[model samples]
Target: MNEQALSVREAIIGRRSVKNFNGQPVDLENINSILEDARWAPTHGLRNPWRFIVAANKEYIKFQDVLKEYGVPKWKELSEEELEKQMKKFRTPGAVVFVVVQEDARQKERLEDYAAASALIQNAMLLAWDQGIGTCWKTPPFIDNPKFREELGVKPGERIMSMLQFGYYDDIPKGRVRTPLEDVVTYYGIEENGEEK
Candidate 1:
């Protein structure tokens, strides 16, 4: 499918988090194309802080190994069966993309960078959905671990934001219902003296 041809509304409504993948390999070109879309996300002060490290095919195995190695200290308490189950979850995805953001000392700048990276992630998810690729953006607890960060090559002034798993799936999951607009939205100007006009 020509993802560029998809309407923004369609992409927004159609995108769903897919947990079950068919073990199909996604092309590197397609992944790059999706990242290209994410690159255009709006940024404050044009900081453009989003950075990605993609692990796919053979590289994915190494990525899993690194995660496991760093994760062992935390999971050492788990039984052998539990550890195996936990490891199985990481094995299925066709690719794993580590989203990182450069730290800024100023609080405002740091928040802005995080917000921009979030927009980039949303754009990536929608773009991938347009091309029939499914994604799950996970911020596992280990992402913040100092050892895990060092193993993943996250720099001194950078932080891992998300771990996005992408692949093709055998089934398209159903979308969940959103809260009604009236319940969540408040019209400030439209109300007069605490009463609706």
Candidate 2:
């Protein structure tokens, strides 16, 4: 590992999921370029099932409304505190990529194929990291709501794998929790008879 390449690797390793954003408007051209890089991710059978959605004026309004449906009745009512919390949704690079898994007939286990497609989100995340943008790949109340999927133009058999929240960060992101490579790596496996072959 050369020093420069190692440093870049470390930078990626140090990336974190940032929640608080400055509400700064990011450059759309930069976002588009990042998406361009993201498309390079390997997909099975070249389905390119992932799709992106940028939350603009009306989209942002609909986003909040959909989020309201996921919470308690009081949240739907939206008190001042509730309203305050929801306001953060508006604050971002002003773009969101609704990574969807389009229905594919090629595979019996389509869910696994969808999962493979969802892996592209990491490519998008890392690309954003390189572009001085912070991201939060949210898969919460957003994914569980089927109606939002339809509203977002998702097809019948398709599903929302994740909601990638992108933005420029005013605050520095915190560190991450990672398991050591030594503990996780498995170099070789023993035989079925428990003999080291």
Q: What are the per-residue Cα lDDT tens digits for candidate 1 across 1-197?
A: 35375799998988899888887877777889899878899999899997999988778777777767765555678898888777766767788899999999999999999999999999999999888899999987889988778877899999898999999988999998999887788877677346767
Clashing pairs in 2: none
For TM-score, the strongest prediction is: 1
Query: lDDT tens digits, residues 35-108, model 2?
Result: 78778877766767777766644455466655566533466477878776765664444566777777777675
By lDDT, who's the top model here? 1
Clashes of each: 0, 0
* Clash-forming residue pairs, model 1: none
Model 1 C-alpha RMSD to native: 2.7
Model 2 has a clash total of 0
